[model samples]
Target: MAVDPSDKKALNIAMRQKLFAVATSRDVAAFEELFRYYGPRVRAYMAKLSRDGQFAEELMQETMVAVWNKAAQYSPDKGNVSTWIFTIARNQRIDHWRKANRPDFDPNDPAFVPAEIKPADAAFDMNEDADRLHRAMETLPPEQLELLRLSFFEEASHGTISEKLGLPLGTVKSRIRLAFAKLRTALEDRS
Candidate 1:
C-alpha cells in the first residue's frame, strides 16, 4: 500500500506510538509492524551510504536489532520514528566503516607492537641523556659549541646562523657538523 507523501509525518508519528507500545508492553505485533514499515527503507539508506550490498544488509539487520533493543530510549518529544530509525541506520554505517578501516593490532607483531616503558624510568633515562649531551657540548670548542647552540636551541638554519655570525655559510655548516660528530663520539664512548 502506498502512503501519500503528504501523510508521511502523521504515519511516522503513528509508528512511534506503536514503538512506544512495543517498549512498554513487549508488543510483538507492534514491533512486527514497525519492522515491516522500516526494514526496506533502512536497508536502502544503508546501501546508499555504504555502497556495498552485503555490508548494507548487515547494517540493516543491526539497525533493526538496535531499534528493538533500544526502543525504550526513544522519546516522541525528541523525534518521530523515521528520524530515530534513520539516526540508528546512520550510526550503524559509521560503526561499520570504522570497523572496516581500523587496522588489526596484533600484540605478537614486533613491528607494530609498543614497548611497555614505565613513566618514571622513561623520565630518568631522558634526564640522564640530557645531562650526558650537555657535558659533551661543554667539551666542544667555544665557537663550535656556540654554533651548535644557535642551530639547536635557537632553532636557526645554518644559512641564518652564518648571516647572524657574519661567517661564511660553509664555515657555519662545517662547525655544526664537527660539533655533532664530537658529541656523537663522546656519547658513544660513555655508552
Candidate 2:
C-alpha cells in the first residue's frame, strides 16, 4: 500500500528502510538519496549555529562523512533517520568549536606563571597598617561602627543602608563620616 502524504509514521518507516539498506548492504543509490535529502537541511542547521555559510558547508560535509562511516551503528530503536543525522551534525559543530577555542598554552603549568616582582616582606607593613585600622574600627560607637560595616564591608549604597537601618539618609552619611574621622585619629595615635 502507498503511504499517504500526511502520514508521518509511514514517511519515517520508508526513510528508515533506506538507511538500513545503506547500513547493511552499502547501497550507494540509497546513500545518495539520503544525502541529497538531508544535506541542505544539515547545512541550514550548521549555518544558523555558526553564522557562516562556508563554515556550515564544511561542517555538513564532515557530518555526511560521519554518517557514511557510522551508518551501521545507527539504531531505529534510539531515533529515526532524521534525528540520528541531525545529532551527528550537532556533534560536529560542538567538536569544531572546542578545537577552535582551545588555548595554545597549558595554563595549569607552573612554567607559564609570571614571577612576582615584589619581595614577600614588602607587604608586611601594609598588613600591620590594616591591623591598626581594624582595631580603630572596633573602638568606634556601636551605631557608627554598624553603618561603616554596611557601607564598606557590605558595599551597600548610602541610601540602601539608610532604608535597612530605618535611619534617614543624612543620618547614615553623618555616622559613617564620624566613624572615618575617629578611625583616622586612632590610627594616627597608634603611629
State each model's C-alpha RMSD to the native.
6.6, 8.3
Global Cα lDDT for candidate 2: 0.89
Candidate 2, which segments miss by more than 4 Å at Cα? Answer: 1-6, 106-191
> Where is model 1 poorest over a 10-residue stretch in terms of lDDT?
1-10
**What C-alpha lDDT values do all the predictions have?**
0.87, 0.89
lDDT of 1: 0.87
* Structural similarity to truth (TM-score) of each candidate: 0.57, 0.53
Native-to-model Cα distance after best TM-score fit, residue 110 in candidate 2, in Å = 2.9
Q: State the TM-score for model 1.
A: 0.57
Runs of candidate 1 exceeding 4 Å displacement = 1-6, 106-191
The digit string of per-residue lDDT tens for model 1 on 1-191 reads 24554697878767877799888998988888888888988988878876888888888899999999999999888878889999999988888778889988887898877887779989999999999998998899999989988998899998899999999999999888888899999999998
Candidate with maximal lDDT? 2
lDDT of 2 by residue, 47-127 (tens): 998899999999999999999889999998998889999999999999999999997888868898887767667778788
